[model samples]
Target: MSIVTTAQAVPSRLFAIYAALFESETGEIKDRIEAWATPPSLSGRGADDDGESTTTLFNNTLQEARRIGLVEDIDDKLRLTADARGGGKKVRDSEVYFLDYMRRTLFDPARALETQQSGFMIALTWFLSSSPLRPMNFSEPPQVGMRAQIGDHAPKTELTSLNRYQNFLYWARYLGFATIVGGRDADDQNARRVIPDPVRAIEGALPAVFAEGNDLPIEQFLTRLSGIFPVFEKGSVREDYEAMLLIPVPDPGQRLSITTSIALQRLADRQRIALTSLADAPTRILDFGSREGRVSHVALRA
Candidate 1:
């Protein structure tokens, strides 16, 4: 029905689909979409056929690709758009195009209240609002504690299953917004909790944020950044969530969420950016745990 129900909506499956059909050259019959996930040897059917399952996976993924505008069914043929041909001849190793397009389509503000993406936005916004030092247990649906937050603005059916939650985690990492950490070996997935560190996502948006110049004042940077991801503090998604809250968020007295601030600090540590303070200049505070600091300007270096 939606990506929330399409459990294997992972990037690798998307890449596999792109690699398989990007070369339709003339036209790829829509049915061929399933061939990508169903190899000849396993194509047998009727009884013990495992092929139907394979085809289902790609079909589900195809719907998502269609949803995100990466490819389309035109005149009964599958056509890869200019987006899929991004690398000129090869499938990109990075999901940059996929994610960028998703940001423009699936994650667009218009769909924020729909189940297709509202689930992700709700879960992510919750993660962003949380403290990085006290990571909330991903084992529980974030909305549990914040039931008051999404009390009723929730889409027709809230995406609340543990399985759908996993799908949320998958998309979050693929889109470069969140990460899971902790557990036995730190690699123990079942025990991992999602952390709101959109470092990579934020890092990629710097160029556009500083489009006119290499450096931008804090306010300008926040505007551009929030424009790219409206789920951030002071953004549309946050406003929507706040509007539904049974109790307003206790004023943090700062615009940046703790999780977002942690991400920016991580970016600074990576030398991908520079956060500077200037005398007599309007500034904003980045409250990352106990390391609170103010910045007047941001400069991109990497």
Candidate 2:
């Protein structure tokens, strides 16, 4: 798509495409390519051929990305470009810039609402809730704990995924939702150590702990009670099982004495904010085209 080199608001299509192509060296055909490639693929799930489902908002966003210059066209193949660089601040390509724009516009707003409801603690909880794997997979058939491969769907344990989780934790602590209960003071140091017990403990309990609505105060909710969970050591679900045999609750937190009514009210407020962000964040697809035929098309968003 042709983009006017102007300083007006960045086109959403260009922004989406740029975001998708920011770090990648290649191009893609559709913006929602990741979603299309994900489990329960969104290809044929859409109504039209080439998986273009008007009903599928992502498919529609991909079309919009095509309209922006972030995607280049050669024959049937589409190419994308990286963010524009060399300003005092780096100038990202349209797609990369678009992704950042989306984050700032939509995601940021949702987070703002969430913070208002429950400070920043809710952000960490929401981030964990959004982890790639089913946090409560242990409750499922075959009863496993954080397996590398669970049937067909694989858990994303890559550094990129880990970085995303760590970023959330970093931001949480920076904002005060998390306090360094243990470990060193350096930013990455605490992340590297065992101080962030809440992440693992909460992951272990989330599928069941928050399964049903319970009235609980924001500060005292036992989302990560240690005694009620099983810990998964790195690379060892078997070790997790053995460990569970040794200690039922490996990292339980102090219990609060607040009445259920007060806790329930706060929980309700936080949940409303969390659910609202989930509902509002636009999951648009971002496609881009590249000038180089070798790295022709790229997709991002969703």
Candidate 3:
């Protein structure tokens, strides 16, 4: 699928809906859902031309939350599940646990691959990892011939992926990973640009890919890591000051291979976890190849 159209095809309000529910008191699920569905002028853009009202957004969010095991529907009342509540833990513990829960619920690649918007999710991952340092400009229309490089590759212009780039800005802002500066512009009715908040992304969304038990396969681990950190490139290039947006081109096979290797090493360096090979094979580095390879399994050190 082409990147541009994919962004427009799926618009997510899951985060907003979740935030509303998270902040509310624990009883009266029906009332809470109804109040959330009410169209507060500031909460969301009005209903779409296709009968997609605020109520529809809330309903979709509820269904998604339930599907991801974040909430339970009991006797017409909605409540956060034990996992969502962080197993009744203390505040900080609960926050971390819930952040991880949010990641699994909304951004898991396995689940995303099963949907129509899989391309959009992949595109989102690409943008986050590839452009972690670059801020996006949303005020002006996307310019043609703006260049960026991922890893060792030469810089390439973003002429082809303009829509996809814009879509990323919209989606990231929607999920609170990025915020629009100066509100909506008067000319195009879009934000001038967006400032990405890595702290917010980590605290709110990145933790979900990690688990305390059971080793994750390299592919799954990389997918989770990709969402946590942007791929680092050596030697900075001149920034494209004129471009109003940026989107990552798909990584070349070699670049992706190198990225995985780097991510594994970083994880090891931080002493946050342990990596092991499949079938008790011994290796220093985690190998992506060999179904029975060393880097195939990852888990928290403890």
Candidate 4:
């Protein structure tokens, strides 16, 4: 007898559909359109039109889920694939637990950095990852004018945080995460729109990867950038103005990847939303929103 393992339940508003698909005696998942979606009762006042929309949402979710191997379609039947194990390990359980501990405890490494309130390390990590080297050289300062002077087309700057942000914007532009507008005034302050592609992709994908009830750290997303390039190791060169660590791009096309820009925008948006939501709560809190918004707005404008 096959031991029936309880499936790792899928989420989103489509959970009802998932439940229905799994509830049948044989727990089969796919069939003709009507099986999974019969319209929800529209009779009651304020009853949302969920029937058709839920199916559409489920269809999108299921297609992506299948693509990522969390589930599969066998003979047009959707079934929990045996391969759907532990959400595919983007951040391991230990890491998630550690993040939680850091958020709650005084000695958390995250708190150490948060207390400093400087994004220097984070920016450095990103810079090293995206560069040709794995470590920064403390011996010499980065050549700010090198890219233009050398006609290399790559930006070189000593402002690590800002440079890192620009690199991310470039990648995001390449990946269709956001669109860049060329026209701007002399001071360079103008509106830049962050297209919704990156947010849609993450909103669709993250739930499949993270465990139920687990909120992945925003820093965890930063780690994903490192996967494209390695930043930390001892032998990497360091000059006073810049550090030259040898980091290799695993995928050559990463130079063209704009996915990061989209993600960064989405991250900025979420932070804004969180702050706004917090403002509605019954507590006196410092308004960091204005400053953060201005900084992000300027970055995107660039």
Candidate 5:
């Protein structure tokens, strides 16, 4: 599987290719993609791929599109899948398709460890949900503070782990979940990376969290979100003939609650749903001032 690294505008460029193919009569896809790649406006904003030949980039994009099921080889010719064709009318539609496609394909646990893609997703989600206002340094590795916030169990020393976190932020920028602002001084290595609209990030991730026609209580939904990445106990367990004992585990419920609340508030701010306290009667509040009432439940609008 080809892992899309940081600083590459794979999604946009691929979408441009898909849209070009969808707009024209069927012919050699490579030739069409190569033509599309020649134009600066259609190619993408990434400077990293400038040195790469158009043919090389086209071949890489084609392979990735096939792997993600956006395109398929039919009778020795490359053709966009029906799903891709359905969303090919607009660039925004194509962008949405690419995100959903990558999410489903990359976030699977079976391939996550090998690909490190799932780790990136989880890290990006956490960053956006927890600290959207902060400016991040894209060139730097995952800081010790970030690792602590993510929990001590998170890998901090491994080169691959560090790369995964960095790549996660890079992917966020590529997908429009975040933005990268270049430093004013050409000599300065520090660039400001901001997630200006975390709500948009949540919107992209919502489909992964909820299924069509499925309604869940807010607590249950938050619990599900927290469990996206498994949290393991730090110590060992011992068993005897009569009893068994395991080391105590830290409670993550509070942290999950905070993260979930952030997501819910962002969604509400976007007018996705109205925030209201569930009331029992005209003059009575059933759960107000209670722990249960603190968490808001959402009802999807028609």
Candidate 6:
């Protein structure tokens, strides 16, 4: 089972464990983190550790970390990986950590191969490759009935239950590749659905994509974007992960996703960027059903 199967391995807790360890230059013994992070719900319940006689919440999560190579268990202590150690030394930003180190590890081709492709990676690729006409709402609720959807797209992609799909949602949302939208009632999650919205992530990455320049070609923008967020269309993550699926993921056309198109349009409207199509230039069209649009170049505006 991957980290998704381990309920205690949610992103917040995972980062908590990671941050605690990151703050420690030297490796920390297992007990220190266990005592601090074990919720009161499972504080003294060793038996609740899924049959591990010597385990608690932290122990179970630590095992999950070890399986994914996030943490090394050596001489009964936990140490963050070398790659995870670098960056924001004094600050240890969770967003940066998750987007960079955690994301890279979770979807790593070799590691994911051994784990049979984590639920998050599988579900994400399906959305990335889905046509704009298809439902991108891959949530955890059965009322929406996404299990059959996955079956239709990739019959071999086995999501054990709604719990696994929920785990996928947690990771997807935390990473900013997806967002929750449109709900009549807060209690009714089925009333709402997760959509492929990477606006926040794109906004955060604006500086990197634009760099010193004020504007760049649409194709260049996508190239830089796919490098940072490899799960997006034409990204390396999709290339690597799609091999595992029995059915080839459907082609959603070569244009940007409907969600991404909306994100760009939102940015354009807010004057964060300018989208234009030159009279004679290579152009990439935004996938908006409401109207036909083409963006050959983008200008980053202050």
TM-scores for candidates 1 onward, in order: 0.82, 0.21, 0.44, 0.24, 0.60, 0.77
lDDT by residue for model 3 (254-299), tens: 2333223444455566665666767754333422333222465667
| lDDT digits (tens) for residues 68-122 of candidate 6 | 6667877878888776665546455645764577666665656576644555566
Model 2, 73-187: lDDT tens per residue?
A: 4444445533232121334343334433323322232433332211122222222222221221111222132232222222222112333334334433333223333444565
Q: Cα deviation of 142 in candidate 3 (Å)?
A: 7.9
Q: Tell how far residue 175 is off in model 3, in angstroms.
A: 6.5
Error of 4 at 135 (Å): 30
Per-residue alpha-carbon lDDT of candidate 1 for residues 1-302, written as tens digits (9 for 90 to 100) = 55565676666777666656655555588767666466766554422232346656666778877675567677888876776555444444434555555676555667544425556676667657767688656677654555655676544224567667667777777778877886755665556677767888898778888888889888788878878887776677777677776777665335577787788888888898898999999877788667678888989885
- Give the range of the ten consecutive residues with the poorest summed lDDT in model 5: 233-242
Candidate 3, residue 59: how far the Cα is off, in Å: 2.5
Give me candidate 2's TM-score against the actual structure: 0.21
lDDT of each: 0.69, 0.30, 0.46, 0.32, 0.48, 0.67
Flag clash pairs in model 6: none
The candidate scoring highest on lDDT is: 1
Which window of ten consecutive residues has the lowest lDDT sum in model 4? 1-10
Q: Which is superior by TM-score, 2 or 3?
A: 3
TM-score-superior candidate, 5 or 6: 6
Model 5, range 1-302, lDDT digits (tens) per residue? 33434323355666666666665435345555566565655454343435665555666767666655667776756777775565445334555555655555554445555544444444444454344445666666655655545444344212134444454555566654566676646766566555433445455545545654345555544444434322101101100100111222123223222333444566766776444544542111112112222433544543
- Tell me the deviation in Å of residue 206 in model 5: 6.7
Q: In candidate 1, how many Å is residue 108 off?
A: 2.8
lDDT of 5: 0.48
Query: In what order do the candidates fall by TM-score, top score first?
Result: 1, 6, 5, 3, 4, 2
Clashes per candidate, residues 3 or more apart or on different chains? 0, 40, 7, 29, 0, 0
